[model samples]
Target: MQLLALGINHHTAPVALRERVAFPLEKIKPALATLRSIWTSGSPEAAILSTCNRTELYCAVEGKASHETALEWLSDFHGVDVSHLAPHVYALPQSDAVRHAFRVASGLDSMVLGETQILGQLKDAVRTASEAGALGTYLHQLFQRTFAVAKEVRGQTEIGAHSVSMAAAAVRLAERLFEDIARQKVLFIGAGEMIELCATHFAARRPAELVVANRSAERGTRLAERFGGRAIALSELPNRLHEFDIVVSCTASTLPIIGLGAVERALRARRRRPVFMVDLAVPRDIEPEVSALEDIYLYTVDDLGAVVREGNAARQAAVTQAEAIIENRVDHFMQWLDARNVVPVIRSLHTQADEIRRTELDRASKMLARGDDPQVVLAALSQALTNKFMHGPTHALNHARGETRDQLLSLVPTLLRQPER
Candidate 1:
């Protein structure tokens, strides 16, 4: 089986398509189980990495399993038409697959050119695959090497320096909507890492009031207390939504938490005052229809891509350095994969040698059992083992004709070379 990476990312598809294919954290394990079932013949190894910007499947698949099969499987699982999804999908086989994994782990493939969040997301994906029993020797080795390469790139290059984080981009975009962030009351709708990050950036501006609303009130309170703010349950959003001028949401809910009607009510409550809203969730925390509302400035994860892509020009040198490091590691990983190919041949050779030794030892043991001269039996056994070991190469060398003979004449000695004292 060979390594294969096939999927769509922010570079290949729009948010509408990406969100359709995205597997949430809770669904990844089942998705992996289903993918492995599709390739029953290969005993396939599969891992899925799903984030706000991308959803990718990495697999080790054997013969007769092409990208078409995987694409069809994905389309069926997500209920998307193959015709529409195929154009945005990419399939990288063997070395290309290895290279892609390395680049993704090292942050070269992220929408935000040196973002570190993807590495953590990848680790979570790999861990999920492991729990699901989808990670075999090949995929396990691939991710381990991928993580190592990512660490090396981070250590050797300044790719993350001067980088524009999504949180910072959200803040910059919010600044354009409001004259002063300090005068605005901000509500963060999730207490996850992304929410924490957004809170940090927004807090730097010292907003008038900061609040956190989460499904788990305790977790929300803990996160809010960090910024000297109070927490509220998600149930309170409808009643309290209009109180905040800016809202940033990133929750794991599969459905839209903030609908058009809710936002409309909030706008009406504020007498049509403009509410700047950012939805950083994958499936989207806010309804897409809400963007059509006249008095609301709503942005999804895709909307922030342009903002985060800015200010990356100065990091180009570090990007190049990181790419170079990834390429070198990719080559090393491919070499290791190549070595794995010869393992069966090496095993067969050892098996043959062991069989020959057993046959010769049986004959020698019979000689000793019959009371034959001990030294003579020992000599015969030693000679027999040596002859058997050399027989194949000697016969091949003797029978080979012309150039083949010359090649074997040169190769046989190396194959049977003795260790130096």
Candidate 2:
């Protein structure tokens, strides 16, 4: 089987193209199953990582499916024309694929360098893929090691210490609006990791109240409990919207959950109180028109990129060390992959040896049954098995007449006896 990674990210494609290919969390499992049915031929393993910044498919296939095949598959799966997607998509194979995954998990490939959230996002993607029955041994190992390398990089290097993350940038932006964050009521929509992260950052400011609104009440309750807040169904947002001073929303819903009219109504209800809103969802949970309202300040992930640039210089300085760590880990992962590739050869050799042993043991048993001395039969069986195992190499060495023969003779004994020794 070969490893492949195919995707487009913020660097290669505009948000418009990225959103077209983006698989919302709710659709991932069905998409994976469909992909498996189309490409994996009943036993394919795939993991998809889809975020506001990137949408990537990591997979292992048994046949000769090259990078182009992966791209074509993605194009077809997304109902996008192959020609249209060809320009924006990137496909990495084998070693390059491993390297790319490691870099991504380490946040070396992020738009915001050393952003820790991508690592957790990757883990969640892997988990979701596994639950969907799309993850196989190769991808499972790849992600496991990818996560390990990320942890190693984070623990051993100062890569993340000086970096400014999107969550921190959001908090910074919010501080600019309110004199004191302690007085603001923060509302988070969608109970996913991003919302959890935004809640964590805003919660640190000791906001007067924290509210989690989600499509699923269970998920919303779970997330709300983390911040000692209450949960509200998304349906209640329209009636309760005016209560929040700061609203951060990221959901997989394709349509805008918070519309322009809702925000306008909320603004009027608040008596023109300035409201800070962050829409981290790609399709945009909050309508774009909401940004035009004078009393409501709205920001998307793209807007946060500007605020996230504050510590860029410090992060750039640490990039050299981070790259070195990622490269080292990539090399280590490749070595492990190389060892995995040789497993079948090693297994075949062992199988051949076992066959010889079985044949010789059968011959000795027959001789003993015919009343031959047990000790003599056993000795002959051992000698015959040893000679049989070494026969091919010994003959090749003795009959050769060139440097090839000399090289084989020199290496044959070591190759044949290494395991035994």
Candidate lDDT (C-alpha), each:
0.91, 0.86
lDDT of 1 by residue, 3-110 (tens): 889999989998889888989787888899899888868579999998898899999976655888889999999999999999999999998999998899888888
The list of candidate 2 runs beyond 4 A from truth reads 40-42, 174-188, 199-233, 236-247, 260-276, 288-298, 353-421
lDDT of 2 at 218: 96
Question: Per-residue alpha-carbon lDDT of model 2 for 47-143, expressed as tens digits?
Answer: 8999998999888887654777778778887789999998998889887899899989988888678888899899999999989988877888888
TM-score of 1: 0.89
Pairs of colliding residues, candidate 1: none
Each candidate structure's TM-score, on Cα atoms with residue i matched to residue i, is: 0.89, 0.76
Clashes of 1: 0
